[model samples]
Target: MAFDAVVTDLDGTVVRADGTVSAATLQAAHALSAAGVPLLAATARTPTGVAALTTLAPHLAFAVCCSGAVGWVPGAPEPAWCELLPRAEVADLVAFLTRELPTVALAAYDSRRWRMTATYQAMRPNTHKGPITVVEAAALPEAEACTLVLGHPDRTPEQLVAALIEGGFDPTRLGLHRAGRRFVEVTAAPIDKASGVLRALRVVGADPARTIAFGDMPIDTTMFAVVGRSVAMAGAPPEVLAAATDHTASVEDDGFARALTALL
Candidate 1:
C-alpha cells in the first residue's frame, strides 16, 4: 500500500532504553518528511512528555497524547482536541480504587498539568521532571482529568489490571490499559491510540488505508486495528504481535529504522 503518513509509539518502539531516539530512527523521520510523508507521535504520554519529541524531530508537529484523550502540536498553547473524564466519575473511581488497593499510587492529569497523590509523588526519582503537583486523591473531584494513572511498585502491569478488575472497575466502561510493567492507565471509555491516530489523520487529511503505524504494546492495538499496515516490534506482547500485519526487529536492534527503510 502507498502510505501518506507514518505513526509510531514512543517508549518501546522508537526510543532506546537510555531514553533517546537513535540516529537511524532520526534519519528515517527526516527521510519521511523529505518525501512528503507526515511523521506523527502516538503515545500514552502526557502533553508534557510528548513535548520532548519536538526537540528531537522538528518534523513532528502533531502528537496524540494521553493514549487518545488529547491531541496537540508541541509548543502550542492549547490542544486541538481533548476528552476528559467527568469530575464526579473521577472522584468515584479514585475513591473506589484507593479503598480497594491501598498500596497503589494514583496520578491524574488534565489537559495541561499532572497531579499525583503525595505517596505517588514520593516515589518519583530525582531525575523525574518537575511541574507535577502533589495533591490528595480527594482533590481529584476538583480537577477534570483526561487520564488516571495507577502505579504499584510491586505489581506488574498485568497484575495491576487484574486487581482493578477485581476492584470493580469494568474494563468495558473505561479504557483500562497497561502502559508498561509498573503502570496501568484508565481513560474515558473507548479512547485509545487509534482514536488519537484517527483524529490526527483527520487533522492532516491523511487516509486511514494509506497510513502505516508502528507500536509495541497492547494500548497500541487500537491503532493497529485502524491502520492499513501495522508493524509490531519483535519483543511486543504475543497479542500485539498477533494483531500486527508485520513484525520488525526489537527497538534495541533499531527496528523502527529497519521497518521505515523497507516501507519508505
Candidate 2:
C-alpha cells in the first residue's frame, strides 16, 4: 500500500523501555514526515504525556490522547476535538468504584490537568510528572472528564477490568480497557485509538486504506482495525499480536524504526 500516514502507540511501540525515544525512531519519524507522511502518536496518555512526545518530535503535529477522548495538537491551546464523560456519570462511577474497590487508586483527567485521589498518589508514587491536585475520592468533582484511571499494583489488568464490570460499569456507557498490567482506563463509550486515528485522518486528509499503524498493546487493537496495515511489536501479548496484520521486532530490538524504514 502507498501509505501516506503513520500512527503509532507511545509506550511500547516507539518509546523505549526507559521512557526515551530512540535516535533511530526519531530519524525514521523525520524521514516519514519529510516524505509527506503525517506521523501521529496514538496513546492512552493525557495532554501532559502527549506534550513530552510533541517536544521530542516536532514534526508529529497530532496525537490521540486520553485513549481517544481527546485529539490534540501541541501549541494549539485547545484540542482539535474532545469527547468528555458526563458529570453525573463520572460521579456515579467514582462512587461505584470506591464502593467496590475501596483499596484501588483512582485518577481523573480533563484535557489539561489531572486530579488524583489521595489513595492513587500513595499507591503509585511519582507516576505523573506534571502538576496533579490530590483530592479525596468522595470529593472528586462532578465535572466533564476525558479519562478515569483505576490503578491496582497487585492485580492484573484483566482482573481489574473484571472487577469494574462486576461493579456495574456498563460497557455501552463507557470505554473500559487495560492500558498496562495494572491500569484500566475508562473513557466515553465508542472512543478509542481507532476513533482517534479516524479523527487524525480527517485532520490530515489521509485515506484509511493508505494509513499504517503500529502498536504493542490490546488498547492498540482498535487502531489496527482501522488502518490498512497494522504492525504489532514482537513479544506483545498473544491477543495483541493476533490482532495485527503483521509482526515486527520488539521495541528493544528497534522494531519500530526498522518497520518505518521498510515502509517509508
Candidate 3:
C-alpha cells in the first residue's frame, strides 16, 4: 500500500446502513492491517457505541469516537484520550435544551461509558451499542458532558440551529454537523473526527498525504478535506461529495471495500 494508514468514518462509511460493518468491509480492514497499514475509526459515535467492531476488527490501533471527544487506543481497558464538556457548561446547556426542546436527545461521554437521556434511550434501536445502561437524565451526575445531541424529523437540523441561536445559545463552544437528513449531532468545538485523526497521525508519524479517508455524510467532510485523497459514498450529501477527491459506491454497495482494494 502506498499509504501508511487508512482512517474511516463509521456510521454510513464503513458501517452498513443498518449499523453493521459488512463482512467484506471488515475483511478489507483486516487485510489493510495485515499489510501493516493501521485502520482508524473516525466517527461521531461514542467509544461504547463503536465497541461492536472489536468482535470484527480487533487489531485496530485507535478509534475516534463521539466525533473527536473520545479516543480509545486499541487493547487498552480505558480511553487513551478524552475531552468532555466543561463543568460549568453541561448543566446550563442541558437545562436550556430541556426547556426549549423537551424531546431532544442528549449524550454523555467519559472514559468508561456513553450515557444518554431517557428520550435517547428509546432511540437506541437506531444506535449501534452493546451492554448499554439505560437511565434517565435525572439519574446522571451534574458534571461535564462531551456533547448534546438533538434530532427531529419535523425540524431540519438547520432550523434547529437557527432556533438555538435565537434562544440565546452561543455556538462558540459547540459543533454542529450533519449525520443524515433526519439527524444532526452537536459536540464540543475541540472534538471532531478530522482533528482526532490528525492527532493520531502525529502520534503514529503518518502525514495526511500518505492517508486516505472515506465517508458518506457531512460530518465526514472535515476528514475528507484533510486527507490527500478522499472517496465519498455515492449517497453522500452535496457537501461531502464536493469535499471528496472522488466518488465511490454507496455503503450498501461495498464502496469502502472497493476503495480499500484500490488503495492497495
Candidate 4:
C-alpha cells in the first residue's frame, strides 16, 4: 500500500556498513518531503546519533531518538518536546547498576549531545561535563548532545543485559538490549521503537494503517507489528523476517529507499 508517511530504523536497516545512507535513499527522502509527505527517523540510537541526519531531508520532522526518550525536532532549532526518564531516576538507576553491576556502562541524554558515564568508547573520543557533575560519570557541560549511549564494548551487551536483570533491576521499569556486539542499552519503560513511533505519529495525527516502517532487529519488531505496512531488512534476524509483513533489500541495497519509493 502507498503510505502517507514513513519511519525508519538506523543501523542495519537504513545505514550501510560504511555508516552512510545510500544516495538513492536520500533522494527518496527528498522526494517524499517535496511531495509533502512526512518522513521520520526512528531508531534505538539516541538523538545525538541521529542529529546529523536531521539535515538529510528539508522536509523531515521530529526524530524518534534514544528509542523515543526525545521527540527531537531539529527543524525548531530547539527541541519541541521530549519524554525522559527522570534525572533522579536515571541517577538512581546508575547508582544501582554501579553497585550491583559495577562494570555495566550507563549514560543519559538531555537532548543535544551524547554523554558517557560508564565505558562507551564507540563514540568519537571526546569529553564534556554533564548535568550531575559527578566524577564517576563523564559529564558534558553545554553538552547539547541528542543521544545517550551506554554499554560495555569489551563484552557483548547480552552478557550485561543478563547481568543487569539478575542484579535486581525490574523489567517493568525499563527495557534492555544490545544495539550490536559493540553496544547495549537500557531505557525507560515503553522505549521500544514501535511504541515511540506510534506516540509521535499520534501527535501529528498520522494513521497507523497509512504509515510504513523499515527496520532490521528485534527492537524494531514492536514497530513492525503495529504499523499497517512494515518491511524487514533482508539481513534482519530470522525472527524479524518471520514477523515482517513484507521483506526488502539489505541496507546496502537501499531497502528503505526501495520500500518508500514503492509506497510513493
RMSD of each: 1.8, 1.5, 2.4, 3.9
Model 3 lDDT per residue over 1-264, tens place: 788778888777777766677888878877887888888888877666667666544856678877777778766678767777665566666677777777776666555655676666665454645444555655444535666566653677788788777876677776766655665666777567788889887777788888988888777888886788988998777878998888889889899999877766
Model 1 segments beyond 4 Å from truth? 124-130
Candidates in descending lDDT order: 1, 2, 3, 4
TM-score for each model:
0.93, 0.95, 0.88, 0.82
Q: Give the per-residue lDDT digits (tens) of candidate 2, residues 123-159.
A: 7676575678888887664545788888876778888
Global lDDT of each candidate: 0.83, 0.83, 0.73, 0.67
Q: Say which prediction, candidate 3 or candidate 4, comes out ahead on TM-score.
A: 3
| Root mean square deviation (Cα) for candidate 2 | 1.5
lDDT of model number 3: 0.73
The residue pairs found clashing in candidate 3 are 44-67, 45-66
> What's the distance in Å from true for residue 13, model 1?
0.8
Clashes of each: 0, 0, 2, 17
**Local accuracy of candidate 1 as per-residue lDDT tens digits, 180-216:** 6578878888888888899899998899899999999
lDDT of 4 by residue, 82-180 (tens): 665545555555666666655656555666544565354334243232233223552432334333445654556666667767767666776675565
